[model samples]
Target: MNMVNTQVRLAARPVGLPGDGDWTVTEERLPALETGQVLVRTLYVSIDPAMRGWMRGTPSYLPPLGLGDVMRAWTIGMVEDSRNTLFAEGEIVTGMLGVQRYAVTDGRGVTKIDPAEGPVSAHLGVLGVPGLSAYIGMLDIGRPREGETVVVSAAAGAVGNVAGQLARIHGCRVIGVVGGQEKCRHVVEDLGFDAAVDRRTEDVAEALRRHAPQGVDVYFDNVGGEVLDAAVRSLARGGRVVLCGAVSQYNSENGVGGLPGYISLLINRARMEGFLVFDHADRYPEARARLREWVKEGSLKVVEDVVPGRVVDFPRLLLRQFDGGNTGKLLLRVED
Candidate 1:
């Protein structure tokens, strides 16, 4: 099989928001598939706030993307050819396929996706990494008890939207903190959260007081920084604060900002825990099965913001996640 490979490569390390010159576009020919390998035609590429960290040459949980390498991304595509017995040709799959028109992998991380069960884009959102993050962050770390209050920042994002809704499912009163009023409305009406605070226009602490009233039991934080500070001030006794992602600090040109004092945690008798979704790999199937069941029963809502263009638009779409331009799981459409 022959196909053109238009790939997005890292040109320079971005200091803050990535510019046009930060990436270089290149083209290559598709390579042949080997035993246990499958050739995939790129369909959609996910844009996550984590990508900003990946571009920097720093020590993180994972190695940073080296200069001139194909920018890493989560992609959903169709198998054009397969030498792997586990996946047949023409099957839809999703994984870290990078930014290119085509990908060839040994099927190590790539998994099959079925649109019949739900929209294919959902495998990248509600049923994918973001969804898993929400499930584990809320239940495993936040541990919202019944009649408790669960507050989430980036409340309309891929992870936060699901996290807030899942908290409600477990009988916790859910309060969402979003960047704008429109997003606040969407979180309350569309996602069915108990209350939605517009962090951009309203004072978060005041809003939290009006919404939660009794103080927050679990803070499922996505956009950290000041939101963390507000949650701390309003946390109830034995409250749990889940540190998921901090879009606010992701692009801080100097460094990650400092949070409020640890003494606050002691005074409140509250605990704050950091979580990476991959840490729950062993339990992904368990989480996915339950989330899938919810989707089938119309209990869970899946939202996706798709930007259409070629592979070159990957960098632009990646920046949107940090800019609050996306409402749900953000993806770049690589093919028509």
Candidate 2:
């Protein structure tokens, strides 16, 4: 019997927010595995903000996903069949599995992970790039000091959630800026953030003043728009802003991100730095090991919002980030 693979491919570059028209889903027969290759059946797909950026014709850290190509995504899968020595049938693995039911690879970028270590979705999240992105970007760039206040935007989302929590673990007062009251509650009530500001309901600059009275020492900026402007205005002397991503601008036609007012940086003597997780690829092992230890010790928590469905749901699901639909690390459960 032949195996059929379902895939979501990029049909065109999106104008602003992607619509269903931008994607094409197709089913095809899977070919026989080659030597040193493994046939993986995807179980979970990571939905991320960066996907929007990758869809555009723009400069990026990685090459844009070409039209007619399978949409690139980080995923966890089960090795159903293998001709590779490093991978075996029935082993759980993580790799760039794309938005597909199955993938055959030469085992180049794949990593074998024990499902018993944690939820497989977590490997795409907290224990995965989301976690590493937070762990590396926050610590390496923000460098929060004890008793200092750290503010993060998109605080209920993946990177922002972990970054804020990790800052709290470093003994800093952590404040989150989210879109609505519900997410605000999740950040403070459940995630232990010191306080949360609802961007849609509250005046962000005033909220910053109230929550970070002494001024913010570190800002882990995930959204780059008006929220960034407010954060810069609230920065204390020598404050540091680590630019993890500009999710808010990924779909913009013009370079209009409501870029932060500059005088504040000079007057406050503050500094802003941008980083990409790909650059720190060398330290991934270290970050992974430490994150695993913290997770096992229960000092860290991972919240994953899984959308149960097949690969065809990916296009609409990607909009959840912009619509404030998902509460935690958003994931697509491709299979049982």
Candidate 3:
């Protein structure tokens, strides 16, 4: 097939938040699929805080995006053409398809999506990496027990919201730490969180104390830095801290901020562990089944912030995640 694919490529490594100069948008005709490869027309590209980390040249869990490489991203799209036996034309799939209007893959990490489970965009949010991260971080790592106090930083976000709600489902008191009043209200009233701390207006440590007077038994942290320190200071005896992500420090020109409250972990006999969602890929089927069930029964709500734009809009759209401009999962809908 003959087609021109629009793509966003890394033009330069960014100092802080990436700007237009850091990227170059171009269009190129796609080549014919090789044997064992599939052609995907990008539908929704996931915008995540980790994308910022991936932009740096520093060593990380994954390799940094090479200069001039297609901006790495997880995307959900339909298989428009396929030479791979594992994938079929018309099948919806999700994988690291990058920031392009079309992706050609060998089906290595791609997975088929069952639309009957929920809206396809949901696969990028509630049932995708965000949901899996929350599930493993909360259930497998934090291990919240009934009536325990669970606090989630960035609670209005994709992973944080689901983490807080999962704790609530397990009979824990869920307190969300979010940015603004509207987000605070959204978590508490709309997402069934027991309480919310407006990190912008309220003192986080003081708020956590007020909400979790018994102490935070489990703290699922998304935004590290001051918020992480506050959570550490408020940890209950034998508390568990799940270090999911550090959105707060992702854009820092200096290195990641100091954690002053880390000493409290030793004092409280608590443990803090960092996790990558890809590490738990073996259990995705199990996680997806449970998430799908909860979403179906209205026990877990799915929230997505999707901006429809072409591939060229990716750079600007991704900035939304860093500035707290979006609630829930942030996705760039690749316009056909």
Candidate 4:
């Protein structure tokens, strides 16, 4: 018996927000695993803002998704079969498995997941890229000292939420810039942010000034554009800015817009630096160990917004990230 694989492929390069027309779903019979190959049954797929950037027809940190190519995504999956010596059958693993029900790989980038740490889905979230990104960006780049003011944009979202929480753990006064009143409340009341700025209703700069009168010492930027400008303007002397993700600009035709408040960096003797989580791959174990400990000890909250659906639902499910429809790490639970 052959396994049938369902996959979501890129149909067209999106202009702004992607629609149903931009994707093509197809099914294929899985080929037998060759030497060093593994077949994985995808369980959970990570929905991230970076997917928008991958759809663009341009050079980025990673090459753009090709027309008709399997949509790239981080996934947690169970190994159904394996010819690779390192990966055994029935093992759980996580890697860039694409938006598919089944994936065939050489197990190069794949890592076996220890379920004892947390749920397998968490291997794609708090224990995965978002968590590692937050850990590295906050400690290595942002470097928020105790009592300093740290602001995180998209603070209710995956990376931003973890970054904000990490800042709080380090004893920094954390403020979250989010959309809507409910999200604002979640950040402060639930996530332990010192304050919240509703980017939808309030003037971000003004709100930052009110919440962080001493100025923002560290800004963990996830949603760029206007929020970035506001954070820059409110920077304290010798401030550090960690350029994580720019979700706000991902869908724009013009790409990331210019930052008008960048001059504040010069005025305040501050620095702005961009980093890729892949660049710190060597330190992932260190980050994951600490993050897992936090999650286990209840110091770090693990919030996941999982949407149960088939592989065909990926296109619509991805829009939830941009529309502020998800409050935590958005995950597509690939149900049969």
141-213: candidate 3 lDDT, tens digit per residue: 9999999999999999999999999999999999999999999999999999999999999999999889988
What is the C-alpha RMSD, rounded to one decimal, of candidate 1? 1.4
Q: Which candidate should be chosen as best, given lDDT against the real structure?
A: 3
Q: At residue 189, give the lDDT of candidate 1.
A: 94
Q: Report the Cα lDDT for candidate 2.
A: 0.89
What lDDT would candidate 4 get against the real structure? Answer: 0.92
Weakest lDDT window of 10 consecutive positions for candidate 2? 255-264
Residues 228-295 of candidate 4 have per-residue lDDT tens digits of 99999999999999999999988988757889999999999999999999999999889988998998
Q: Rate the local accuracy (lDDT) of all candidates.
A: 0.88, 0.89, 0.93, 0.92
For model 2, how many clashes? Answer: 0
**Root-mean-square deviation of Cα positions for candidate 4 versus the true structure, in angstroms:** 1.0
Residue range 43-138, candidate 1, lDDT tens digits: 899888888888999868789899999998999999988999998888999999998888889999888898777789888888889999999999
All candidates: TM-score = 0.96, 0.97, 0.98, 0.98
When sorted by TM-score, best at the front, the candidate numbers are 4, 3, 2, 1
Q: How close is candidate 1 to the true structure, as a TM-score?
A: 0.96
Candidate 2 wrongly placed segments (more than 4 Å):
none
Worst 10 residues of 1 by lDDT: 255-264
